[model samples]
Target chain A: MQALFGQLLVGLINGSFYALLSLGLAIIFGLLNVVNFAHGAQYMMGAFAAWMAATYLGVGYFWALLLVPAAMGLVGVAVERLLLRRLYGLDNLYGLLLTFGLTLIAEGLFHQAYGNSGSTYPVPAALRGGVNLGFMYLPLYRAWVVVVSVVVCAASWFVIERTKLGAYLRAGTENPRLLQAFGVNVPLMFTLTYGFGVALAAFAGVMAAPVYQVTPLMGSSVIMVVFAVVVIGGMGSIAGSIFTGIGIGLVEGLTRYLYPEASSVVVFVVMALVLLVRPAGLFGRQR
Target chain B: MSRIPRVACCLAALLAAPTLAADKVSDGVVKIGVLTDMTGYYSDLAGPGSVLAARMAIEDFGGKVLGKPVQLVSADHQLKADVASNTARKWFDQEQVDVIADLVSSSTAGAVMPVAAEKKRITLLSGPGTTAFTGEKCTAYNVHWTYNNWALANGTGREVVRQGGDTWYFVTADYIFGRSLEEDTTKVVKAAGGKVLGFARHPSPGTTDFSSYLLQAQSSGAKIVGLANAGADTVNCIKQANEFGVTPKQSLAGLLVFITDVHSLGLDTAKGMYLTTAFYWDMNDETRKWSERFFAKHKKMPTMVQAGVYSSVMHYLKAVQAAGTDDADAVMAKMKATPVNDFFAKNARIGPDGLLRHDMYLARVKAPGASKKPWDYYEIVKTIPAAEAFPTVEQQACPLAKSASPAVMKK
Candidate 1:
C-alpha cells in the first residue's frame, strides 16, 4: 500500500538518526568501555552550531555539514581530555554518571540561553521540497539525511572492521592495558575514540536540525529511544547497531501506521522483548 | 560580586528615590512577583516578555501605586506545579510580594491559584488556557486573563463549522490543557451542527513526531483536523502536516497558538491556518505603538500573553490606587468593578467568575506572498465580542458565579 511505503520511508529516516547516534555510542563503548550518555546533547549542540553558523556567520547548511562535526569533535577532545579521561579506569557507571551530568550541563546552558521555544533552521534552498518516488512522496532533505547517515554508518563500520587502525582499535578494546604496555598510547586512543564517537552524534544533529524543531530538549525527546536502539543492537557491535537501528526504525514506522498512539512506546516494547529472548541485543554476541 | 557594581546599583536606586518620593504614592511599597516558565516550553510565550510588559505598565503608571514604590521580582517555575507552589510560597511569605502575575501554564496556574487563595493574594494568569481554573477550580482573588480554552475553541470552532466544514478529527496533546481544549471545542463544534469523527491523543510536552497521528487523522476523512495542543507540539504538528500534504484536503485548526510559534514556522507552512488570539502587535495603532516599545526592549513583537500581562498589571495597580489599600479583597473588588481600557483590551471587564471577558479575533494566516512585512502573519477573519466569545452565565458553574451574578457584564 502507498501508506505502508510512505511510513517505511519515514521509518528509514528515523532509523538513520538512531543508526548514527547508536553507532557513535557503540564505538565509544567498544574502545573505552564507557557508555557515553552525552551523545544526544552532543548531537543537539551540532544542530545549534549549524544554526549559529547560518545565523551569525552566513555559513549555509552544506558548509555546516562539513564544519559542525569537525568543530564538535574538537569539543569532544576537550571534554575527553579535561573530564572523561579522569574516570578512565573507574567503574563504567562513573562514566555513565559523568557523561549524564555533562549532558545536563550542556543542555542546561542552551536551555538557559534559548528558552524552550523551538527555533527553526530553515531547510536549505536546494533541499527545500520533495519528489514523488514510485511508492511515496519523499522530501529531498529527508532522503539526503537517510543516504548520508547510511553512508557514514557503513564507512565507520568498514573503517572499524577492516583498517589497520580499526584492527589496532579492536585490539585496544581487547586489552588496552597490554596495548599501552606495547606503546600503543591507549590513553590518546581513548580520547580520539571518544571524540570520534561524539563527532558522529554531532553529524546526526546537523542532519536533524532542519527536520525537527531545534530546541534544547530535542535531543532528550528521542535520546531514550536511540539508547534503546543501541541496547537492542548488541552494545558494542558496529554493524549490529546499524542494522538494528534501521530495523527498529522500520518497526516503529509500521507501528505508527497500525497503532498510532503506541508509536513512541513501540521501540521500548521491542527492546524489552528482545532483551527477554537474546539477553544481549539482537546483534550482540553473548558474553 | 564587586563593591563598584553594588555602589552603582545603590546609586541607581538613589537616583530613583526622588521620583518615588515625589510621586505621592502611598508610603507602603507594593511588591508584585512574576512566576512563569522561564526555561520550559511556554517560556517565550509569556516568560521574560511578559515580565518586561509588566514593568512597562508600572513605568507608564509612574512606577508608584497608592503612594508607594511598586517593586517587581520574578522566578522560573520550570513548568512544574510543585515548583510553582514552592515559588509562590516563597514570594508570598518571605519576599512580601503582594500580587503574583503572568503565571503561564495551567498546571502551574492551577497549583499556584490555591496557594494565592489561601494567602489572600491576587493571582493574574496571562498564559494558561484551561478555564477549569475558573470553573470547578475557581478560587477568590484569582483572575484568568488574556485567553482560555473556551474562548479559543469557541472562536475557532464556530468559524470552521459555519464555513460548511463540519466533520472533525482532533489530534489533542494529552494533558490538562489539551483535554480541556478538546472538551471546549467539542462543545462548540456540536453546538454549531458539526459532528466529530474521532480524535487521537499524543503525549503532552514530549511528542516530536506527528506523522502517524496525522496519517490517522487523514484516514478519518474528516473535513478538519483540529490541533488541541499548544507551543512546540502545535508547531511540530502543523509543520509535519504541511510536509504530509494534509492541508489541501483537510483544514488544520490550531486551537491554541502563539505568535512565537508562527514566527518559528515560517509563513510558508502556516499560511491559511485559522487561529484565534486575544492580541496581535499590529492590530491597531495603539497596539503597534505599545508593541514597538516592547519590541525595542525584547527585540520581538509582544504575544497576547505579554500584552495581557501588561493590561492586567495596569488594571491591578489602578484598582489598588482606587481602593487606597494593598488588601487583596479590596483591590480585587475594585478590579472587578472597574472596566479595563488599554492597548491590550478596550472595555474589557472581570466577570463574576473572575474571567476577563475580552474580545478574541479569528485570524487566518496570510500567505507568504500576501504578507508585506515580517510578523504580518494574520488577516482577521472575525471579531467575536466578549459576550459571544466567552461562556454564558448559566454555562459557567463556577461557585462564585452563583452569588455575584454576572450583571456586571456588558453585552
Candidate 2:
C-alpha cells in the first residue's frame, strides 16, 4: 500500500512535465492552427541553454529560470517571423514539416557537439536533498516542480480564458480579418502567442535540467507521450490537457507498479481506446 | 603441332593456379566495417572512438596486409536490429568488407552475426556485453571481444556480496542484454549466499525518469540495488538514486558500466560505487602509452571497447598477414591458435565458443577528494584472473565446445 502511494506520487511528478509540455502544444494548436512539431527540440534547446548559461557564464539555476525562457522566446519570435509566418496561409502539413526539419537540424547540431552521454546540471544547493515522507522520500525539488507547474498552468489558463486579451486572441483565431478590421494586430498577436507557448516549454526545460541529464535527445523521448496526452484531452482544450496529463501520469504510474514492462505503452493504449470510443476526443467539440 | 602446344599451355596454366591462390587478398584490398551506434545512447562508448581505434590499428600495422592497402568503412546502425542486419548484409555481399567490428548494441550484434556467418566474413565484437553471443548464439565467424555479462556479474556481484551486501534488488532495463545481466548477477548473488528480494524492470532506450523505479527498489528494503543496464541508462539511474537518497542507504552495483558513464556522472555522485571492467587506460606504462595516443586523437581516454577494437583489429591484421590470405576460415584458425598479447591483454586467447578470455579488473569509484586528476575515477580493487573471470569452455552451451575440456589456453 505504501509502495502504491509512492508510485502515485512519482507519477504525479512525471505528470507535471507532461502537463507543462502538452499545455504548450495545446495553446499553439488552439490559436495558431499549426501543430508545432519542433516543440520537443525547442524544449531540448531550453535545457541546453540552461546548461550553457551555467557552464559558460556562471549563471545559476534561479537566474536561468527567468532568462532562458525570455531568450528562447526571442528565438521563437524570430522563427515565427522568418519561417513560420510564410507558411501560415498554406497547408498545416507545411508548418509541421518545416518544424520537423528544424527539430532534426537542431538535434543533429547538438549531437555533433556533445556525444550522447550527456552533460550534468547539478541540483541547486537550496533544494538538493529530499524529505522523508511516511510513504516515500520526496525530493524537495520535485515538490517545487509540481507546485510551480500547477501555478504556471493555472495562470496561463486564467489569462487565456478570462482576460480581454485572451478574448481578442480567441477572436483572431475565429476570424482574423474580422479582428483585424476592429483595429487589432492579429499577426503580431499570433507571433507573441507562439513565443509565449515556446517560453512555457523553455520554463519546463529549466525545471527538468536538474532532474534529468541535459541531452540533445531528451525532448524527443517525452514529446511522443506528451502528444498522446494532448490528443486524449482533445487538441486545444487547455484545461482538458492539464487534467488528462496528470490523469495519464497517475495511470502510467499505476501501470509501472503493476506491470513495469508495459508502462511505456500504456499511454498509447489509452489513446487508442479513447479514440475508438470518441473520435473527437473527450473534451473536443465536434467540428 | 597445334595439339602439342595446347597441352603444354594447359599444363602451364594449371601450375600457375596454385601460386595465384596462395596470397589471394580478396578484391585486391582488405576492408573492415565498423557498425556501431553513431548517434544514439551507446555512441559515446563505441561510436566514433571505435572507428578511430580501428584506424590507429591499421596505421600501426604499416597500413598494408598481404601487399594490399587496408581500408576502413563505418555506418550508424542506429541501435536497431534490422538496420544492423541490412548494413552487415550489404557490407558482406556488395562492399567486400572482410570483417565487421564494434557492434555495440546486443540486439544489433545478434542480428548481424548470422549475416556475417552466411557470407563467410569475420566479426570482431568489442561491445555488446551479452554472454548469449558465446552460449546459445555462438557463431564460428565471430569473436566476442572486450567483455561479457558473466565476467561482470561475477566480478562485481560476488565482491559486493562478500563485503556484506547480501540482499539484492534490481532495477533492470527490459531488453535481452539487461535481462541477461540481471539473471547472471542473480546467480552470482545467490551463489554467494545472498537472497534477492525483488526487482523492477523498466523499458529501454527511452526512459528518462527513473524515480518511479528507484522508489520501488527503495521500498523493497534490499541492501543493494543492482543496476542491470549500461551506458546512459546506468548514468541516469545513478544520478536519480543519489537524488532520492537511495545511495547512502541501499548501495548500487553498476553491473555494466563504462568509463564514459563514470566520466559523465563525475566523482562526487559516482564515488564509492563498484564496477567491473575489461581494461582501464591508466593501469600501467604500456596501457598509458597506447591510451595517451588514443586520447590525443579522440580527445578523451579510450573506453575498454575502444581499446579492444584497436587490439582485436591489430590481431586480425597480424593473423591475415600470417595466413597470407583474407580467407575467413584461415584467418579464424590463425586468430584462435595464436595467443593475444597487447596493452589491453597480456596473454588472452579466444575460446572455442568464440569468447576471448582475459583478466577483468574489479574497481571502486574514487571519492572526489581521493581523485587527484581528471579521468582518475576508479581505484583498482583487485585483478581478477582470467580463469575465474570468464565462464569455462565446458560451461558454455555452444555445440562447437562439446569436445573441449575446462582448461585455460596459453601461448
Candidate 3:
C-alpha cells in the first residue's frame, strides 16, 4: 500500500516532465500547426547546456535554470526564422522532416563529443535530500519539480487563454491576413510562440538534469512518451495535454505496481485505445 | 628414366607443401570483426574501446597470424538480435572474417553465436555475460571470456550475504542478460542462506527513471537491494537510490558493474558499494603498463570487456599460429590446450564448454576521499580463484562437457 503511494508520487514527478514537454508541443501545434520533432533534441541541449555551464563556466544549477531556457528560446527563434519559417508555407510534414533531420544531426554531434555513458549533474545544495514522508521518502527536488511545473502550466494557461496579447496571437493563427490588416506582424507572433514553446521544454530539461543522466539520448527516450501524451491529450489542447500528461504518469505508476513488465508499454496501450475510441482525442475538436 | 622420375617426385612435394601452407589461411588474409553496440547503453563499456583493444592485440601479435596478414572490421549491431545475426552472416559468408569478437549485448551474442557455429568460424566473446553461452548454448567454435553471471553472482552475492545483507530485493533489467544475472545471484544468495524478499523487473536498453523500482525495494525492507543490471541502468539505479535516500538505509549489490559506470557516477555516490569484475587496470605492474597504453589511446581506462577483447584476440591469434591453420576445430583445440597469460587473466584456460575460467575480483568502490587519482575507484577485497569462481565440468550443463571423454576434458 505504501509502495503504491510512492509509485504514484514518482509517477507525478515523471508526469511533470511530460506535462512540460507536451505543453510546448501543444502550444506549437496550436499556434503553428507543425509537430516539432526536434523538441527532444532541444530538450537535450538544455540539459547539456546546464552541465557545460557548470563544468566550463563555473555557473551553478540555479543560474543555468535562468539562462538556458532563454538561450534555447533564442535558438528556437533562429530555427523558426531560418529553417522552420521556410517550411511554414509547405505541408506540415516538411517542417517535421526538417526538424527530424536537425534532431539527428544534433544527436550525432553530441554523441561523437560525449559517449553514451553520459555525465552527472549534482542536485542543487538546497534540494539535495529527501523528506521522510510517511508513505515514502520524497525528494524535495521532485516536490519542487511538480510544484514548479504546475505553476508554469497555470501561468502559461493564464497568458494564452485569458490575456490581450494571447487574444492577438490566437487571432493571428485563426486568420493571419485579418490580423495583418489590424497592423500586427503575424509571422513574428508565430516565431515567438515557437520560441516560448521551446523555452518551456528547456525549462523541463534543466529540471530533469539533476534527476536523470544528462545523456545525448535522454530526449529521445522521453520524447516518444511525450508524443503519446500529446496524441492522447488532443494535438493542440493545452489543458488537455497538461492533465493527460499527469494522468498518464499516474496510470503508468499504477501499472508499475500491478504489472511491472507492461509498465513501459501501458502508455501506448492507452494511446491506442484512446485513438480507437476517439480519433480526435478526448479533448481535441474536429477540424 | 630414373632421374626423370626423381625430379618429378621433388616437384610434386614442393608444390604440395606451398599449397598446404596457403590452404592454412583460408582467404589468405585473417579477418576479425567486432560486432558491438556502437551507440547504445553498453557502448561505452564495449563499443569502440573493444575495437581498439582488438587492434592492440593485432599489433602486439606483430599484425600477422599463421604467415597471413591480419585485418580488422567492425559494425554496430545496434543491440538487436536480427542485426547482429545478419552482420555475422555477412561477415562469415562473404567478408571471410575468421572470428567475430566483442558481442556486448547478450541477445546479440546469442544471435551471432549460432550463425558463427553454422559457418564454422571462431567467435571470441568479451562483452556479453550470460552463462548460457557456456552452458546450454555452448558452441564448439566460440569462447566466452571476461566474466559470466555465475561468477559475478558467487563473488558479490556471497560476500554481501555474509555481511548480514541476508534479506534481499532485486531491481533487475528485463532482458536475457539481466534475467540470467538475477537468476544466478538469487541462487548464490539462497546458497548463502539469504532470503530474497522481492524483486522489481524494469525494462532495459532505455529506462531513464528507476525511482519507482527503488521505492518498491525500499518498502520491501530488504537489507540489500541487488541491482541485476549493467552500464547506465546500474548507474541510474544507484543515483536514484541516493536521491530517494534508499542507499544509506538499504545497501545495494551491483551484480554486474563496469569501471566505466563508477567513473560516470563518480566516487561520491558510488562509494562503499561492492561489485565483482574480471579485470581492473590498476591491479599490478603489468596491468598498469598495458592499461596506461590503452588509456593513452582511448582517453579512458578500458573496462573488463575491453581488456578481455585484447586478451581473447591475442590468445586466438596465438592458437591460430600454433595450430598452423585458421580451421575452427584445430584452433579450438589449441586454444583449449593453451593457457591465457595476460594482463586481463593470469594463466586461465578455456574449458571444454568454451568458457575461459579466469579469476574474478571482488572490489569495493573506494570513497571519494580514498580515491587519490582519476580512475582509482576500486579497493580490491578478495580474489576468487578460477577453480572456485567458475562452474566445474560436472556442474556445467553443456552437452559438449557431458559427451567429451575424460582424456579430452583433462586440463
Give the winner by DockQ.
2
lDDT of 3 by residue, A76-184 (tens): 9999999898888799999899989999998888888988888899999999887898999999999999999999999988888899998887786578889999999
Query: Which stretches in model 3 have alpha-carbon errors above 4 Å?
Result: B1-23
What tens-digit string does per-residue lDDT give for candidate 2 at B257-322?
999998888888899999999999889999999999999988889999999999999999999999
lDDT by residue (tens digit), candidate 1, A124-155 = 99986777675555668888988998899989
* Residue B270 alpha-carbon offset, candidate 2, angstroms: 0.2
Clashes of each: 5, 0, 0
lDDT of 3: 0.92
- TM-scores for every predicted model: 0.88, 0.97, 0.96
What is the lDDT for A216 in model 1?
Answer: 90
lDDT, candidate 2, at A225: 96
- TM-score of model 3 vs. true structure: 0.96
Ranking by TM-score: 2, 3, 1
- TM-scores for chain A over all candidates: 0.97, 0.98, 0.98
Model 2, B186: alpha-carbon shift in Å? Answer: 0.8
| B117-220 per-residue lDDT for model 3 (tens digits) | 99999999999989999999998898999999999999999999999999999999899999999999999989999999988999888799999999999999
Model 2 bad stretches (over 4 Å): B1-22, B403-411
Q: lDDT score of model 2? A: 0.91
